[model samples]
Target: MDVDGEERIAAPREVVWHALNDPEILRQCIPGCQSLEKTSPTELVTTVRIKIGPVGATFNGEITLSNINAPESYTISGEGKGGIAGFGKGAADVVLIEDGDETILRYAAKAQVGGKLAQLGSRLIDSASRKLAQQFFADFNAAVAADGQT
Candidate 1:
């Protein structure tokens, strides 16, 4: 599966970047995310409850950052296992650019799934992934804006 998308946040680049990396902001933005922790400057550990169609599982994963350019761009790759439900791994290249006072967040991501998830078919996976990504960014934008207002 591949995901190519972008969102323009109505905030400064610095504000967008700060919200992007903040654990609290991320947890609130990521759907089904129960916990997220920064194990290292370039690594994150996460736990999320996922439900696709009739399958539900808890995924515990670690994500590593590479090709980082700080507040501008980075590459993230992560793999997660949900017991018998199977495993998922994905890589995304994210870029951020200033658009006046706003920041545009662009990303290209590819993913592979195995086990029960793959059995559900590509259409389902693709739809779910896009929905999740959209929700995350929407939440992120709202959170960032709220923080600025307060």
Candidate 2:
């Protein structure tokens, strides 16, 4: 599945960029995230719990950042294994554009799933994916805006 969207954050591009790279910030913004740890400058390990349809699973994943251009754009990719529930892998190209005092964050993403997740049907998976992405961005926006105010 493919998803594309943008968010206007009430912070500068540099602040948004730093927040995006901060594992603590990411853990707070990502729905269902149990833990997120940065193991390297360009990599992180994460655990998240999620339910798709009737299947609930805990996913352990490694996320990598590539093609990075500081305060500008990068490609973020990851693969998660959920035991029998399924496996999910996806990549997103994210860009941070300056919009006066705020930042316009844009992303284009593609994802694939296997095992029980794929058996659940594309429509359900797509809807769930979109919802999760929206929730993440909303949380991220709030977190960054609040930080800027402090």
Candidate 3:
């Protein structure tokens, strides 16, 4: 599956960039994220719970950031196993553009699933993925806005 979208944040590009790289911020923004720990500057260990169709599982994963260009852009990739529920792996390219005082964040991602998740059908998985992505950006925008006001 392929998913891509853009969001406009009411903050400076630098601030948006910082939030994107911050594990605490990501932990709060990611839907069903149980934990996200930075194992290294470019790697993170994560646990997330997800429910799709009739399958619910907790996935342990490692997310890696590469081709990083600081406050501009980077590529992130990860894979997780959800026991018998299945497995998922994906990669995303994220870019940040400064629009005066605001920031425009854009991403293009590709994902694949195997096992029970794939059996659930592409429509269901795509819908769930899109909803999760939207929720993450909404939460992230709110968090960044709140932080700026403080």
Candidate 4:
């Protein structure tokens, strides 16, 4: 499944980029994310509880950041396993563009599923993924805006 979206944050590219790399900020922004640990400058490990339709599970995931261009663009690869629930692996290409006092964050992401999660089909998976992504960004924007850090 594939999902993409763009959000305009009322903050400079640098500030937005910094927030993106902060595990504390990410832990708060990610929907259902109970914990996030920055094991290194380019790797993050996360634990999240998810509810899709009637199925609920906890996912443990690792996200790796690469192709860094400072406060410009980067690529992220993530993989998660939910035991009997299923597993998912995906990668995203993210570009942050400067828009005066704001930043335009664009992303293109794709994922592959296995186990029970794969039985749900692409439509359901795509919809859920898009909603989760949207919620994360909205929370992130709100957090940064609240701090007046952007």
TM agreement with the true structure for every prediction: 0.96, 0.99, 0.98, 0.96
Ranking by TM-score: 2, 3, 1, 4
In angstroms, how far off is 61's CA in candidate 3? 0.3
lDDT at 90 for candidate 4? 95
lDDT of 2 by residue, 1-150 (tens): 999999999999999999999999999999999999999999999999999999899999999999999989999999999999999999999999999999999999999999999999999999999999999999999999988888
State each model's CA lDDT, in order. Answer: 0.91, 0.96, 0.96, 0.89
Model 1 pairs whose backbones collide: none
- Cα-lDDT of candidate 3: 0.96
Better of 1 and 2 by lDDT: 2
Candidate 2: deviation at residue 48, Å?
0.4
Deviation (Å) of 7 in candidate 4: 0.8
lDDT of 3 at 82: 94
Global CA lDDT of candidate 4, please?
0.89
Model 3: per-residue Cα lDDT over 49-87, one tens digit each: 999979899999999999999899999999999999999
Q: Give residue 135's lDDT in candidate 3 (0 to 100).
A: 95
RMSD of each: 0.9, 0.5, 0.6, 1.2
Compute the lDDT of residue 32 as modeled in candidate 4.
96
Give lDDT tens digits, candidate 4, residues 1-150.
778889999888888898888898889999999999999999999999997766678999999999999899999999999999899899999999999999999999989988788888778887888889989999999987875642
Model 1 over residues 32-140: C-alpha lDDT tens digits? 9999999998899999998988888999999898998888988989999999999999999999999998999999999999999999999999999999899988999
For candidate 2, report its TM-score. Answer: 0.99
